[model samples]
Target: MSTPFDLAATDELLSTTRAVRKRLDLERPVDVEVLLECIDLAQQAPTGGNRQGWRFVVVTDAEQRQLIADTYRRVSQSYFASRAATPTDDQTGRVRSSSDYLRDNLERVPAMVIPCQQGRPESLPLAAMASYFGSIIPATWSMMLALRARGLGSVYTTLHLVDDGEQVVAEALGIPDGWTQTALIPVAYTIGTDFKPAKRPPVTQIVGVDGW
Candidate 1:
């Protein structure tokens, strides 16, 4: 079978698109046009019923970024404390360390993107809630892939959306009611683009053939 695209490059892009944290170059500025281009590409992702309701609120202002970062740090304190009380594997511990670093330096990142959906999922049925989130998550992932392809690095964090943190951020960003902020992504150029695939279990261990 003849493939129209370069499989090696395509596979490399997919495999190496990592959840960047400590390696994010905080001093480098990501261009607004590049972000817009990524969002444009992200919009091509599939949406429920073809209702594309994704809204990306990008925060580049220092003041706003600080406010959001503060909220994230405050909310993360309890989470970090909880994790500290429990035992974790080496990989999880490393992830927590990088998450701590990111929490401390989030405000310094070049840009923060809050991917949002148009509707609220509160009190909805499980299926409805899944449908609501299903619409936006794919687009957000697409945006991350696009960012990685452009030499930009990002990690999706949801700490700020905990409890009252969402309302506080909504007020800060002037995001109106009914819009659910899915995840907060810090965007910046990477120190280098030599990312490799992370370790994972074989497909046989994780995948279920028709049934678990």
Candidate 2:
């Protein structure tokens, strides 16, 4: 069967959509309309049972951005600190350094995207747990791909979900009761559109044929 889409272009876009951090352009402002358009495209991604339970909070207000950044840093400081203490390979060490850079400059990024779901899943039954979160995560990744196609950068950060940090962020954003915050994504125009595919272990090492 012949596919109508351009395979090369699709492959390039999928492979190059990276978790951008230090390369995010902090000085420029992100137009909310563009983000909305991306979200529109993101909403098309398939959801488990088509439950469609995703919600997004876009933070562009400086004070609100600062508040979220502070909450994130309060949790991330200990996380990155512990990672820094342990020895790591060159690639891992670079990631640690870039993570620290992102933590320091998270407030400056023009937009903060918080993805949410309809309800708490922590104590739910196994199937319920899978369905609830399964509905939103793909949409979030779709949003990232949409952003990348538009020359924007974003990093998915969940450090702030630790302990009471999520509650603090929800209060700051005025997120109503019963919604569960999934992740905070920092977004902005990228410094350049030259991202390459990241290194990974060979497929044979990571996959199994029909069984683990």
Per TM-score, the best of the predicted structures is 1
Q: What is candidate 1's lDDT per residue for 21-88, written digit by digit as tens? A: 99999998888999999999999999878999888999899999999999998877888888889988
Angstrom error of the Cα, residue 113, model 1: value is 0.7
- How does each model score on lDDT? 0.92, 0.90
Measured against the true structure, the TM-scores of the candidates, in listed sequence, are: 0.98, 0.96
What TM-score does structure 1 among the candidates reach? Answer: 0.98
Instruction: Report the CA-based lDDT of candidate 1 relative to the real structure.
Output: 0.92
The ten-residue window of minimal lDDT in model 2 covers: 75-84
Per-residue lDDT of candidate 2, residues 154-181 (tens digit): 9888999988899999998888889999
Off by over 4 Å in 2: none
Write down the worst ten-residue block by lDDT for model 1: 74-83
Model 1 deviation from native, Cα RMSD in Å: 0.9
